[model samples]
Structure formats: structure tokens, C-alpha cells
Target chain A: SQTIHQWPATLVQPVGSPLSLECTVEGTSNPNLYWYRQAAGRGLQLLFYSVGIGQISSEVPQNLSASRPQDRQFILSSKKLLLSDSGFYLCAWNGGTANTEAFFGQGTRLTVV
Target chain B: AQSVSQHNHHVILSEAASLELGCNYSYGGTVNLFWYVQYPGQHLQLLLKYFSGDPLVKGIKGFEAEFIKSKFSFNLRKPSVQWSDTAEYFCAVSSSGNTPLVFGKGTRLSVIA
Candidate 1:
């Protein structure tokens, strides 16, 4: 079975600090990885998606960026965090060729103070 | 780009009550639909998906959804909901097999005894 791992479960950082969230997948290769932000009533907002290593597609223009350094390793990073950047960040992956449902990792609750 | 709409913000229901959560997507071309559930402290899991063929799709926990292409709608339903069904439900859509998914404002379901 495939599984996704994300960390840290909760993060508290001061404003203008750097941010880094990591997500890794096991039991699958060449999977499609995605980063999403879950808000109160706004639902899951797509931030970035990677099809392969070094290939990333961003949906929203914001202070965050994503990198796929390996086939199953994805990282979400920001040079400087903003107050608005604090939210529930979720990492997900799926088998691209099957058009299947995505599997999510336990989300990271980021609090930018 | 594809966008998804889930109108219900919160729904409270008693055990055994029927459920029908509305989901609509805006995309003219071929699309893939999915429903995901997130328990109180867990990651998101696939509830059901409709890629092609048979408009009605069945998923785990007695959950199902019907895709009505003419109406551009994919509504999730359950014959009888249980207390365990209390969670957040999200609708997602993708333009192709390899594209990133667009999610809607999620619906929070709270089932009581």
C-alpha cells in the first residue's frame, strides 16, 4: 500500500521567517505530488503540483514554492512567511496514469505569529 | 483551468438520515471527479471518484456519488449516515489524468445519534 508522510505536525514561526514543509511518498514511483491549503470555509486551495523531478506547476501566486527533488520527495518552501500564510497545509499524491483519487498526508498546522 | 463548487458549508444530521451534498464543476472538456473525506484528526481519504462511464460511483462506508455531466454536477449521497460520518467532505476536479486537481469549499458534516 502507498502512504504519504508530512511533517512537522504543527509549526509556530515568527513573521518573515523561512518556512519549509516536507512530504514523502512510499510504495509508488513517478507519482503526482500536490500541495494544498485548507481553510475554514474556503476548502482546499491548490498551491503547487509536480509531475516529475524539477517540474512544478503552481496554481496560486503567493509566498510559497514547491520543489520535487526526487521522485517521491516533495518540499514546500518559502523564503519569508507572512501572517496570511498560516493555515493547514496538506500534502497529497496520486498515480497519474490512472486518474485515481489522491492520498493525503496528515496535514501540518502552520501558525505564523 | 477547472474550478469546483460545494455549496454546503455545514450540515447536521441524525444517524440513519439520508445525505446529499452538492458538487458542481466548471469545465467543458473531459474531466475527472472525486470526493474525499477527512476525519477529525486524520488525513483525507478517497470516498469515491468518477472518471468515465457509469455515472453512479460507489465508495467506502456506504458512500456514493452520481456524476451528471449535463448539469456539470457530481453529488455525494449516502443511504444512511452514521456518527462516524461526521467529517469534512471535499469535491475535486481535474482536467486530465496528469493535471492538478481543483478543490471546492468543503462541506462539514456532523452526524448525531
Candidate 2:
């Protein structure tokens, strides 16, 4: 069975502080990884996605950046967090093949104060 | 590039009521569609998905969605929604094969008892 793990289920950081969120997948190899932000009414926003290690495609222009250093390890980082950056962040992965469903991890709720 | 749109931003319904949430995507070629649900304090879970074959796909929790390629629509339906159905729903789309999934600004379903 495949599973995803995201660290720091909840975070509280001051504005302008550095931020780092980690996500890793188990029981899967070479999966397509993704990062998303979930807000109240704005829905889920795609932040970044990686087809493989060191190959990342950013969906939006923002302060956050994503890196896939390992086949199953993904990291989301920000040099300086802003109040607007506070939200629920999610990590997901798929088989990178046809007719496959993506799996999500327990999201990280970051509150920038 | 692909985009998704969810018609309803927020909906309040009573238990046992019929429910329908509209979803549309911007892409002409082969595409995959998906629906996800997020409980108040839980991760986003896959509700259903459409890749090939039948246009209509049934999901967990007595929910379903229909895909209309001509209309570029994938609308979610529930014959009898329950109070437990009060959660946020998201619609997503992607190109066939290995491609990034794009999501919409989810619909918030609040089913009252």
C-alpha cells in the first residue's frame, strides 16, 4: 500500500520568518509529486509539481518554492513568509501513468502571525 | 495548460436533499477529471475520477459525477446528501498520460441536518 507523510501537521510562525515543509511518499517509486494550497473559498491552488527529482514546474508566481531532492522526498520552502502565505498546504502524488488517481497527504496548516 | 472552474463557491443544503455541483475544464484534447472532498480537519480525499470509458462515474459516500465532453463539464451529483456531507469539494483536470493535475476553486457544501 502507498502512503504519504507530511510533517508538522500545524505550524505557527512570525511574518518574515523562513519556512520549510517536508513531504515523503512510501511504497511508490518515481511518482509525480505536487504541492497545493487550500483556502476557504479560493479552493485548491497548485503551487508546484515535480515529475522527477530536480525537475520542478511551478504553477504560480509566489514566494514559495518546491524541491524534489529524492525520488520520494519533496520539500516546500520559503525564504521569508508573509501573512498572505498562511494557509493549509497539501502534498499529493500519482503513479505518473495513465488512468491513475492521485493520493493526498495530511495537509499542513500554517498560520503566519 | 489546463484550467478548471467550479460553479458554486458555497452551498447550504438540508439533509437528504439532492445535490449538484458544476465543474468545467479548459482543454480540448484528451483529459482526465477528478473530484475530491476535504473534511473540516482532514486531508483531501479522492471522491471519484474520470479517465476513459463511461462518462458517468460513481464516487464514495453516495456521490457521483457526469462528464460531458461537448460541454467540457464534469458535474458532481448526490441523490440524497447527508449532514456528514458538509465539507469542501474540489474539481480537477489533467491531460492524458503523465501530466500535472489542475484544480478549481472548490465548492463548499454545507448540508444542514
- Model 2, A20-49: lDDT tens digits are 999999998999999999887788888999
Candidate 1 residue lDDT tens string, B1-113: 78899999999999999999999999998998999988998778889998899999999989999999999999999999999999999999988668888899999999999
The candidate 2 chain A region of ten consecutive residues with least summed lDDT is: A94-103
Fnat, one value per model: 0.78, 0.75
What pairs collide in candidate 2? none
lDDT of 1 by residue, A1-113 (tens): 89899999999999999999999999999999999999999999999999999999999999999999999999999999999999999999988764787888999999999
- Model 2's TM-score against the true structure: 0.96
Off by over 4 Å in 2: none
DockQ of candidate 2 against the true complex = 0.75
The per-prediction tally of clashing pairs is 0, 0
